[model samples]
Target: MAASDNTPATSGLHQQAVDLLHALTGRADAHFHPGQFEAIEALVENSRRALVVQRTGWGKSAVYFIASLLLRARGRGPTLIVSPLLALMRDQVAAASRAGVCAASISSANATEWSQVLGQLDRDEVDVLLISPERLNNARFREEQLPQLVNRMGLLVVDEAHCISDWGHDFRPDYRRIKDLIRQLPPTVPVLATTATANQRVVHDVQEQLGVGLVESGREPVMTLRGPLARASLRLGVLRLPSNTVRLAWLLEHLGSLEGSGIVYALTISAAEDTAHALREAGYNVEAYTGRTDPADRERLESALKDNQVKALVATSALGMGFDKPDLGFVVHMGAPSSPVAYYQQVGRAGRATERADVLLLPGMEDREIWEYFATASMPTEAKARAVLRELGEAQAPLSVGALEARVDIKRSPLNMLLRVLAVEGAVEQVQGGWQVTGAAWHYDAPRYQRIHQARINEQNAMLDYENKSTCRMQMLVEQLDDPQAAPCGRCDNCAGAWYPTHVSQQAAENATATLKRVGVEIDPRAQWPVGLQRLGVPLKGTIAPGERAAAGRAVARLTDLGWGNRLREIFHTDAQGAPVDQPVDQELGRACVEVLAQWAHDGWSGAGRPAGIVSMPSVHRPQLVQSLAMGLAGAGRLPYLGELALAPGHPGGAGGNGAYQLASVWQKFQITPQLQTALDNMNGAPVLLVDDLVDSRWSLTVAARELRLAGAAAVLPFVLASRG
Candidate 1:
């Protein structure tokens, strides 16, 4: 079957696809967008590999859905769609149902549906199957079900296909497995990869990956259908506010006036939560959506925004990609995204079906710092990769992530990502018990990673350029995405004069200031010691005895909090020598700490009496800051100031690493000095408030509290200026 076949059968198939399109949209006048029908024809008639690089609202779903039905009608097997987000899968499933395509999904979220979905697949009852990329590697699915599915799969659709490329803004390691999946699929099956956020680099990378095995089979190169990326409906702008409080005030003053319900994007979870809280306090109907948001709640929130029941959902990147709401009125970024392409993807959510919608970027001073942190965290280093490989190679049995976390210094999230990367490279395998070495040779690929790192830096700079540039915001984004037809969108704030109000009422500013100033974030104490600590030469395992455990603690603020976070970041800011500045507590922060203590005491300290005295942890870096905070609190509360704990000589001082390593670094590192012992004795076994500058792993707090409890204090109440999550 060739694209130029044009037989009566091909003509009938095209007519059927057109009819299905009308059924899908419930509009008799509904017609295909520019590349939609061609993409469908390529897949259905020619069974060709196609990459559709269209804008967000460009009906990429229609092309695949129509092709799937056309292929199934020809006695082909079920269509297999590897979708990224669960929300996207839900939307696709519902849309399939409306279009008379029986669709089913199997994901971690729906274990109960697995058997039923499998049954439907075996019976040829399911017309389309949606799954996450990670699902392809599930042991049972990969070993048992995937082979059969691959043999029978009529059409393979990779939604959000940008994720398959390392150059993609939101690349996931599991998405690389799709390349292997493409190779495994029958040569006759048509493959469709779709994304709205791929630049030329990403597009070429995706095209190459999609062509895997096809060219060897003498199949033609993938047909790429790219369209102009500009969206006429979006009215873009950048509003530079001085601080987080002013931005919140701006939203308070102007959010209600926005045309309809939409998203308010934040860079981090804490920022999203804080912004949503402020908006809700201002009497706006909004909720915070983040990775931390519950799955059920995410579905509910998506529905709420879709139905226009809420003014907005203040969300992190979790709400992005494949979230469909055609008439979303606005998208307001609390801070600019690290990439112009990513910003375009998120803001593209607005005005899909409507005549007009607003998109605004409220660039923040902290955005770069946040971007840098994530950029580094996401990329695997050569040392860490080799460390993981060495650990797996040495293990006799497969090592679970918990075991690997203790053996390797990487945390669980990054460790999982690293394992996936290794597995993809044929250096590791995830078996039933855990992960094991695959005995395959692996190289560092340093040059490639360096190139990617530089690319990310360039993207960050482009985003900053987007914020500062006086030219068309939309044009800058399209150009960043390599849209050759990128022309000035006449609707943006620059082309047209500012359409949004910048005024913040004095009352609103005061209210926002109050919200940001409010403090007191609970620091939940670590209950159990990390597994495999014994292997780390630390004889700690299982739950810490309740008697030895520090009571749930308090931090004046999280290091990421909007209000106190800014101040705490400055206090903990590193000096030119790359060491924490050993400064005393400032009056403003001191008062805030006192207010936190007052509230904590009022809220009841785990049903204990007030703290009898204060003791400071031995901080190798910020000792002065810790001591000042402890002494200030002791003096304010009229309690005795117990002497500080002594740090053992030759103790490891740096922070970071996983739980086991962090605990091992500080274990037995703090000793109760004789003077501190005497001070604790003088307190008559009362609870002691143990103060520290910051809590990262909580190991320092836990280890210090254990020493205090063992050294005569009745209870240890850990207090910190900030908690780094």
Candidate 2:
């Protein structure tokens, strides 16, 4: 493409920046926002590092895009963007394309395209390359591709830059690696970091990290542009529904009238899915977007919402951050987020390119439960971190995650989180096969994590305050971010009155109860054994042989489910006094379990005859819970109750871990009672019902079923009260 006739002849950098900004925005008359021009000038003319903490829709992407164009024109290399999510990268790539910039991404969603993207980069045909933080730890990428790219990178842009700070509401251990990365970049290269949800503390930490390895040059001071975060387009409100029942009913009654296509946020994936299902049944064209959503399906759903073909998206935090739709109409929270900053960020997604978008929060008593669970999930434990280091140090070669799990007792998710934390701290380095110790002395930084934990407590309290505050809701939120510009907005319920209705009809309430009362969740069977099982002395490999695997099992609901999760948590949660005592199964949930089996039977489940007998899995903590469930099911279905499966004297409990470790822990560990074997032998070929409290890794069920099948049971149908994801 040729330059415009209006392109000024041999101009200064400022004129060039202005021209590029117009091209970037596709508006010849487009000019920069107050701080946008300054940021561009800092990056392009002065080659200064900068951090921009402005609201969403403030053209943070434009700052880097326009700056990249100007620098590349001067023969600088491609800008490397460390993006956090696929949705963000997709939007940025599209946004850069509209600006006539060539951009490509390498992420899990496009693993097949990495070589092509690398080829493009090799040819210098890419203007920007977007990669996840996890990519930085890829040994091959770091040792081979990264050094070359880092040497020539014209500018480094950290989108969602607040994540670089541990103090940020959504702290990611992977993002901590950017500090090491920044320290390696040449001082002459400019860096720009951008986020929509940082306060003073987060801004200061990010700014300090952005200044890493930049001590040599006489670059300008790191510019910090923080504008007032109050978005006047949002009309905020809080609806304190008495229960999840009333909340779902209110949505059933009022969702259609809310506004144009938008997002309805739920705190958990289960809630998001259940809410979407209920809303769809009520004739709303809604869909659920969660971490579990298929990548292709997420793309499809996002497109549907963008095209207004869907009413609203029911989504978890998975849908948050840099999901761009200029005309996204509103955002509704079914339950409050853990932090006001997080809440602000989700609500910020709405009203970016619209006027007067509705933002409402319906707080729940269960919100605190969810908060407590997730707040401590990523905090590093000294014992776990030390165990990983020891494992890696003692290994002759790098151990893959599966191999590492077999050696260590930690579950996969927490283990992976610890690995990332160790990687960030320079204690462990991911290698070709798996991971290795770096020999770097690492401390657990208890104070920092403790501060983060307490900060979460403070944030939770602030969220509650926002819900019940007599002052302006919007002001309270902005203030929670420590924004100096916070002020009362007359649009909130407290400021004026609620712009939303508070009433749900009895019919809608009944519909919600019907939806919530519905039970049964699919237990995804383990199709393949964990890798390196043979190394762990278990012969299993690829697929679990068809006959030995349990049939698609049945559970009333996941512990995360909105319908039964509440009661299950009550049964599972350790109270202030101590651990949950073993209690009898609730009659309603027991009936729900019966309902699940009944439906399974209707769906042609009983091949060898409706379960010949019921057997309970042995439980050290909740033996009574298991017994009560087995007895109730046996009574309701008129089946004989076989006593609990026997365990060796010192047999360990069914704690969750990866497949190989769990299987190794329980392999041949259960002893079939002589009475049970006699009972099974007498049946001559009959299916048996196996019951348990919960299923996580499912190795116990698998091993137990293998034992039962070996002991003459024709088929084993595994049932559980709850499944943990």
Q: Point to the candidate with the largest lDDT.
A: 1
lDDT of each: 0.89, 0.85
Error of 2 at 678 (Å): 1.2
Candidate 2: pairs in clash: none
TM-score to native of every candidate shown: 0.97, 0.94
Q: Give the runs in model 2 whose Cα sits over 4 Å from its true position.
A: 1-15, 215-218, 531-542, 573-576, 606-609, 654-656
Q: What is the lDDT of residue 655 in candidate 1?
A: 67
Candidate 2 residue-wise lDDT, 615-720, digit = tens: 8898878988999999999998999997778997775555545667777777767888999888888888688999999888888888888788788777788899
Model 1, range 360-396, lDDT digits (tens) per residue?
9898888988999999999999899999999989999
lDDT of 2 at 446: 83
Model 2: number of clashes? 0
Candidate 2: minimum summed lDDT over ten consecutive residues — where?
1-10
How far residue 341's Cα lies from its native spot in candidate 2, in Å, is 0.9
Return model 1's CA RMSD, one decimal: 2.7
Worst 10 contiguous positions by lDDT, candidate 1: 1-10
